[model samples]
Target: MAKETKAQRETVERVMREWKDGALETSRGAPVTSQQQAVAIALHEAGQSRDETPAKNRKNLRTTKAREAKASETREVLYAEATKRGIPGRSRMTKQELVRALQPR
Candidate 1:
């Protein structure tokens, strides 16, 4: 029930149809790849009207913000640790790769 732009609505509808057509997978239900899909499905299950704003959408937005903040903090810490350790290419490495590289052998 979030106020979606036309493009967003089309994207959600396409995803749902593809899911039904067996053209998509949840990729083992990984949160990153499936988050939007989950939201769409949840709205559908809750009988969310396109014109009515959903309370759960607001709650979910808060949750998403919290997750993003945590991830940003983690990236900052990882960058600092990598810099301290003098890890080559640390600046270019992604968060997950930095974490793997910094893990104890």
Candidate 2:
């Protein structure tokens, strides 16, 4: 395989940073999947224009949205149940907190 140029290396590093830091989320705040990351990397490597990145990113965003939506639905159900059971502070908890509280005791 050919060696990566500095520009290519920089681009890859940027993408990896975004992926690791959860910047590839949808407007609704869903985390992008590995598959989506792969697609974004592939597109970037192909020398796709910067202006076109958003469209390509949106495609991946859709998948993340779907996954997040499903997870949200499940969390809502769990949260409601927790509230009904008088779990203190459930109302104030964020999603991550809710998950921890709802985990099997």
Candidate 3:
């Protein structure tokens, strides 16, 4: 097997450090899925420069934020509907619970 060059060794080390440090977390404050981590690792291995990484990460963050906002809005609507119908425990319910409780019996 051919020996790895210095640059390839450096790239591997960087990717490993990022993974160990949990630096690839998703925008929603969750750990990135293994699939995402693999993509990022592949990109880094391809010698993609660091200057481009932030922009791609930022775009992902914006999309995650939008999705979270939509989910929050849906939860709020469910809460409002439950309150209007005098459903008890609405305030205590999680978003999923609120959705279920607000559904037509």
Candidate 4:
């Protein structure tokens, strides 16, 4: 299981949501339209950039998986969990969108 700190997960969710709404912008004030670019920007802003070496990335993943309460699971795992949890519109959600819908307030 991966453990995303609440703040980290929220950062990703907020950024992606803004991207979907055509509200996310780049450093140059251009609207962010690419999903991949949005994710990269989200992670980078969260200080978990994928630009790092593979080993470091793997280490980060492992650490997240081994974390305690409310641990974040793998995409497949989380997807299945979401299905069972009856998350609305889950059938249309990409793996990265899980955090936003979980136990939504």
Candidate 5:
């Protein structure tokens, strides 16, 4: 882990305090309801958390986005996409399987 600057540390503290006070919000105008989400938002606002470098933070952000995107899709939607794509064995495939089949390469 890299050393965090005073400003960065302060940023985290401020954001966390906001979260604790029920004043923290996500970029999309949603109220931050989870400690994990608050921490991620705090670290992002600070440009880095104590535990990760900037590069790692960006990577984690990308991974979180991808997972959220996947989770946003319903099983019925996945099935429709799989059917449209003519995926093999889609009839018996699970929702996860359909998602994997439909995932962009």
Candidate 6:
């Protein structure tokens, strides 16, 4: 494995600081609740996480499909939640739109 560069470390540190300050969140806009969780998420975003298995030794296609299936399930759940809340025009909103609309003001 290649060594991590100074820039990568700096980036991770910055993200960690932001997360600790409640200024950063996951792609879904959920706040990170812990420093350890922040480190993992930051490293994954930087492509420097220690937990990634070698792609050649893994079933890449199956993993990708599984992730997609999970995302679809999440979208369905969000849609249903929005429907339950009686959000106007929910049927016409995309998943992300629903998410944004559902966020507390």
Query: In the order shown, what is each candidate's alpha-carbon RMSD?
Result: 9.5, 12.6, 13.0, 11.8, 10.0, 9.7
Better of 4 and 6 by lDDT: 4
In candidate 3, list every pair of residues with a backbone clash.
none
Which candidate, 3 or 5, would have the higher lDDT against the true structure?
5
lDDT of each: 0.57, 0.58, 0.58, 0.67, 0.76, 0.67
**Best of the two (4, 5) by lDDT:** 5
Which of the predicted structures, 4 or 6, would earn the higher TM-score when compared with the native? 4
- TM-scores, all candidates, are 0.32, 0.32, 0.31, 0.46, 0.47, 0.45
TM-score between candidate 3 and the true structure: 0.31
Cα lDDT tens digits for candidate 1, 26-62: 5354333455765565344333535335666554444
lDDT of 5 by residue, 58-78 (tens): 665455456447757998988
Candidates sorted on TM-score, descending: 5, 4, 6, 2, 1, 3
- Which candidate gets the maximum lDDT versus the true structure? 5
RMSD of 1: 9.5
lDDT digits (tens) for residues 6-105 of candidate 3: 6545555655665667675443557655855745653445344254565674454444344334456677787887889999988899886776565443
TM-score of 6: 0.45
The alpha-carbon deviation from the true structure for residue 105 of candidate 6, after best TM-score superposition, in angstroms, is 26
Residue runs of model 3 more than 4 Å from their true location after superposition: 1-73
CA deviation > 4 Å runs, candidate 5: 49-105
Report the lDDT tens digits of candidate 2 across residue range 1-105: 335555545555656666777675543567776856555654454344354665664554344344334446666786896788778988788776676566444
Clashing pairs in 6: none
Q: Rank the candidates by lDDT, best first.
A: 5, 4, 6, 3, 2, 1
For model 3, how big is the CA root-mean-square deviation? 13.0
By lDDT, the better pick of 1 and 4 is 4
Q: What's the true lDDT of residue 63 in model 3?
A: 42
**The best candidate in terms of TM-score:** 5
Stronger candidate by TM-score (2 vs 4): 4
Which segments of model 4 are wrong by more than 4 Å? 52-105
**Tens-digit per-residue lDDT, 22-102, candidate 4:** 998896779998999999977765446657765665555444333322245666776787889988888788765765456
